[model samples]
Target: MKAETVRTTLTIPRELLEATDKAVLEGKAKSRNDFVVQALRRELAAQKREEIDAALAEMASDPDYQAEVLKLEVEFATAQWEALQLGETPK
Candidate 1:
């Protein structure tokens, strides 16, 4: 994989930082940076999923919007299935 490096700073609670360091020493992560990155990624993915589901639910509550969204969902599903058959990952 191609990679690039960047420098950034974060302000975190002292307790949180100490806990993260402990986790690193316990072998939960290669370093404090790795732990924070993995945690942020997981949190972001969960938040996005929650937002999508909330939007779908709101749309479903409206009869007309529900129909349109259902149609789009079907189309998306079909495309995902086709991509899977072609050995591509669908996101």
Candidate 2:
């Protein structure tokens, strides 16, 4: 299936355009358009990941979640200390 694409004009720095063309000639990209599209896709994906990470950080900072995490940490430390006292390595 062919994806519909729109023609657009963007004013980019001359050096950047030159680099893009170089990439195409070096076979790093099929063409300048492909290089730009791939760059945009990567940037968009990175933005999405940042959004998800922010949401997760907010959720983790919730009072209830923080309390549970603290409880688990204490339990883990106690278990590790007990294992050491018993001369057993806690793997």
Query: How do the predictions measure up, each by TM-score?
Result: 0.68, 0.69
lDDT of 2: 0.94
Q: Which candidate has the highest lDDT of all?
A: 2
Cα displacement (angstroms), candidate 2, residue 63, comes to: 1.7
Q: lDDT tens string, model 1, 1-91?
A: 8668577999999999999999999999999999998899999999999999999888779899978878899879988888778886554
- Every candidate's CA RMSD: 8.4, 5.1
User: In model 1, where is the ten-residue run with the lowest total lDDT?
Assistant: 82-91
Q: What is the C-alpha lDDT of each candidate?
A: 0.91, 0.94
lDDT of 2 at 63: 96
Model 1, stretches more than 4 Å misplaced? 67-91
Q: Give stretches of model 2 more than 4 Å off.
A: 64-91
**What is candidate 2's lDDT per residue for 40-63, written digit by digit as tens?**
999999999999999999988899
